[model samples]
Target chain A: MKWCTKDIILFNKEKEFVDTVVVPLVPISWDKNMTATVREGEHITILAREIEHQLMGRMVEAPPFTYLKSESMEERMKRLKLWEKNIKESGIGYIFYLTSDVDWNQKNHNMLDMIWLPAVPLEHMEGKARDAYLDETVQDILKVITESWQQFSE
Target chain B: MSNKEHDVTRRQFLNYTLTGVGGFMAAGMLMPMVRFAVDPLLQNKKTGKMVSVVSVDELTDQPQRKTFKVKKVDGWHEFEEQKIAYVFKKKNGDIMALSPICTHLGCTVNWNDPAYPNEYHCPCHGGRYTKTGINIPGTPPPAPLHVYDMKVKDGTVYLGDAHPRGGA
Candidate 1:
């Protein structure tokens, strides 16, 4: 659900049903790969919004966990783990770390599902092509989500 | 100049006419500007303009999802948003359109999911609704899915916003 007053109120009332949270990982960098970083951020952010719309009844999108690209991996992990802890304590069964970063995908996340899909340059694509690309990507991610749900239930 | 020359000075007459003409010109320029400034405020709120979505003859006993564009106004900005409505006909031959948004936590419900046959199923939390969109007892959904305000024209179906069939 969205981070709005109306949705938040509803979330509280129906917290039991909303058992999942998708945290979008956005990397911010104004240095060498600044343009690429911005593009990746846009890609991941748009995907997060679409995913929220698709599965909004079941999950809440945690506010994006944006970290600087220059920061040490150890420090970033430490910070993110804290968010995971808080969310778990509050009764979220499924925690997904959605990103377009290959580095994050390579890392070992025990409980949190690290979903990494290559960033598509949607801004450069036409409307039909963009939708076709986005729909395919969203469907792929949704397959991962539902499969995981089945595995967890089993 | 001969008959009414005593009425007023030449300077006074010119001053009155000049000021009157200048005032008219000023008002003419200001009028459009004033209207433009308040044009959005003066715009009528088109709350319920029914847009025809699909033809009436195509609807069957089974519900079919139709997509339409809704003009959404947010303060000064206005844009068209894509929306879906599920239309079907009852045994009595009357048409009904239901919004897919689940009443429980605002999730989209699907018609006849593989897991739940012949019923609307919420994939999120297992909420179930009957063919008529009534929430089953003990389900997560507390109320029935909303019905779209609908009208049937010559051969087309026009739909407005969905209104809740309120219940605890």
Candidate 2:
């Protein structure tokens, strides 16, 4: 019965796998002091290991509207490497999840979902869609997504 | 006068002894106050002075980072170059200035971050603001970035430490 339990889905949209990444989910190093939560929304932590796997093309889409904070490209990559190393050494699955009111599937929403990628370098995120995963200067886009999702749920 | 010749006057001895003791006590009491008053006047350092950070020609309609220095006096020494950060732009073709100092903690903010793209970033604390200097509440920063009050005379931009962000 325990083995029959469903694997927690990471993404809403399932794309054909580039490869079957069955590597055991490892826990990540998260600062207990650092946390964020929206009113009646999800609390999530994006780890460095997941970032590495995502960048390596092993994983598909990152969680919709993940927020990250970083300064430069080299530093971001270095953080990813460190996150990956932490996961490997700890043998504790690094990736974790939090469900939020914001739905990526919704047509148009007007609520901002903060996806904090604290370790990712800022310079690398420039002009990239992944930049949304970082602290957005203008959170209007994410706001729309969250609002839409909230309406859908109701 | 035969055994012990004593011509010393009592008045002279009393006067000499009292003057010596009085001078020592007076100096002891006055030392702390003298040092206290003189130290501040002597050691007072300039926090920062108003300086021209950008010129009209240098500032475009788009926000651009401009670096300048102000002489900060410390004690007897002078800080020849204290780096000050600002965002320069010409809104409606009129030159304007924005201070990069975050309203929350006074940390210098950078205008361009490849990570956040169009947001200004504070490294000391995770303070962030839009290009237009609006505060994003709930983050580490409590308020928006400050805009330096300025005037354009002929062509150059002059700045003062008048915090005008969100009426700060």
Candidate 3:
């Protein structure tokens, strides 16, 4: 479910059913010349949106956590941990962190499931190639999410 | 009467009459626009409009997933969205159209997961519901799967809005 008022009402009423939360970690850059970083940010946002659309009934797409490019990794990690704790306290059973930021070290954050995707320069790609690339990425993420659910059930 | 007094009275009368006529004309022009804005909001949201989903002959005892597109209005924006439902025929010959969305968390539930035969299984938190869309208590689900308002005509199945059944 999306983080909209209508969906949130349903989520609140059926909190037990809404167990999975997917958080998108996006990196923003203040540098004017960092067009690549900005493009990557847009790409990750699209990827996250696609994931949410595909698994709408199963997962709540939390508002994205965007960190500045200049921010330290330690600070971002700390913030993520806090978010994770709060989500868990709210009775969420499964939390998946989706990111296309290469600088984000998934190894350090073991508290939540992290899906790291390589940044694809989508602006350079065209037509069928871009669609195929997006479809492939979504499928990969779907596989990971399903596997995580399977593991949780067991 | 003096000429100035007579002129002043005529001007005042014209001013009052013109202002009143202008106000009435503006209200006349605005009435339909105001109604147009509020009419949709006042109309019954449940129009009971039905859209054909699948053919009755295609349905079996096993629930099958069917996807259909429907136009949805969110405030001023209107767009078509794909909706999913699980359709099946009960043993008693009644056609059942169950919304795939799990009542617990709004996740899509799959019918007849190999692990749980004859039941809808939610992959998100392992929420389960019986074939009849009744939630299995003690699980995560707080209510049963929503059942669509369904009707069959000439072997074609049509569905309206889905209503959630409180927990079993």
> Given candidate 1, what's the lDDT at residue A103?
72
Point out the higher-scoring one by lDDT: 2 or 3.
Answer: 3
Extract clashing residue pairs from model 1: none
Better of 1 and 2 by TM-score: 1
Tell me each candidate's TM-score.
Answer: 0.75, 0.37, 0.62
> How do the candidates rank by DockQ, highest first?
1, 3, 2
| DockQ for the candidates, in order | 0.50, 0.02, 0.31
Model 2 per-residue lDDT tens digits across residues A56-144: 22222222222332233345335544544553453422232223223321323223122332233333454434434533422332233
lDDT of 3 by residue, A1-154 (tens): 7999998887787676567889988788868837867776788788888777766766789999888988888898889899999998988888998887777654466666888888888988986587668867886888788887787577
Ranked candidates (lDDT, high to low): 1, 3, 2
Model 1 / residue A35 / CA error / Å: 3.2
Residue-level lDDT tens digits of model 1 in B1-168: 666857888799899999999999999999999999999999897888999999998999998877777899899999876567889999999999999888877777878878789899877777899998999999889899999999998999999999998664
Interface RMSD over true interface Cα atoms for each candidate: 1.3, 16.3, 3.0
CAPRI-style class, candidate 3: acceptable
Q: Write the per-residue lDDT of candidate 2 for residues B37-132, one digit (tens) a residue.
A: 899788655442457666677766568765454565567897544334455554556555667666654545666666567787754344688777
Model 1 residue B112 lDDT score:
80
**lDDT, candidate 1, A55-109, per-residue tens:** 8988888889999998888899999999999999999999888898777877776
